[model samples]
Target: MAHPATDDARLPRSGSALDVAEYFAPQRTSSEDLPEIEPLVKNLTIGVLEVLAGVREVDQLARWLGEDAYRALVTRSNLSARARSARGVAAVRPAHRILTQRLCEPTDGVVEAVVVVAGPARTRAVAMRFEGWDGRWRANSLALL
Candidate 1:
């Protein structure tokens, strides 16, 4: 008798396993399928600045950020907090206004944006790249200049 463990019918076809795994993985949605990108980008810019300024907790924005972006924000926030502690500065809401926002879509589900913000101290730009993931936008990369 043939061994049941070695039965070909019990195993998935060569490439079907990969297909099955991918089917269960988080799906990538196109920008056309997602909500407006401008609003999300603007919100994230302000959120990131607030977190760095010690006025907001990084966890508050975790839902919209990818793993790497979230970790980077946490690290930057920690550094900011340490600096504030050394200077004996208390956390205060940063006064800033969004000046200009420019967005570009290089591919179907990706958006790159730069937002200029005018703060009481100086004007700065926040750059971010967003990807449509699982039917929503997620920030995978962020930088404040």
Candidate 2:
């Protein structure tokens, strides 16, 4: 009798084993293969600020963010909404200007940047890390200071 493993008809006949983990894993794209990242960074910075300010929904920016970053933004957005509720402050679109942006590339496909924004109330800095994945830029980490 044939062994159960060898008798399986579902296995590939090509003789080359398939690596399920690697096949399903997120693909990392090189910087050379990606589009200009500056525009994406700037847009994402503004989008994130809007989300946290409750002027925009986190889902609007979900496609540009990784799993962890998306979850964190959702949590932060919820907290902001709760705080607004507590203070009885209606959600208003924040009027702000992007003051400056500083970026650094520690790796070929990864960029770390900080954007300084000026608002009517105060100036704040948003730090973010973007990685090239599957031919697009995705925010993997973000922090507002």
Candidate 3:
């Protein structure tokens, strides 16, 4: 009995175009080199989260935001008629353990999220935002939904 050659010639060349390298070329993609999922949320959340991971003071939270919104977000705890909402939640003197999430529109790179702040409450749903810098994906505004 003979075994199949199992080489490039044995396989369909067009389908195997990405076979140039063993590790990197696994598939031949027609789409752009980007993820299928929307990046609307994940990108911002990830950046803020990464910065927060290194944070030792309240001021650091303001740094993740755009210039105009920073002042509003840092002024004090005030979001709605709801008393002392997650407003300045990160600035609470002591941080809370809670879930943080980013809902995505990957292609647009905009997102919404529920950021876990303090005890019991656990999360805040941030929604309806855009992500872009010169038409490229960036978290333009992060809001609590």
Clash count list over all predictions: 0, 0, 16
CA RMSD, predictions in order: 2.9, 3.1, 13.7
lDDT tens digits, residues 10-62, model 2?
56665334566666678999989999888988889889889988999999999
Name every residue pair that clashes in candidate 2: none
Q: Compared with the true structure, what per-residue lDDT tens digits does model 1 show for residues 17-117?
A: 78889988989998889999888888889999999999999999999999999999999999999999999999999988999999999999999999999
TM-score of decoy 1: 0.87
Worst 10 residues of 1 by lDDT: 11-20
lDDT assessment of candidate 1 = 0.93
**Cα error of candidate 1 at position 100, Å:** 0.4
What C-alpha lDDT values do all the predictions have? 0.93, 0.90, 0.40
| Position 117, candidate 1: lDDT | 100
Best candidate according to lDDT: 1
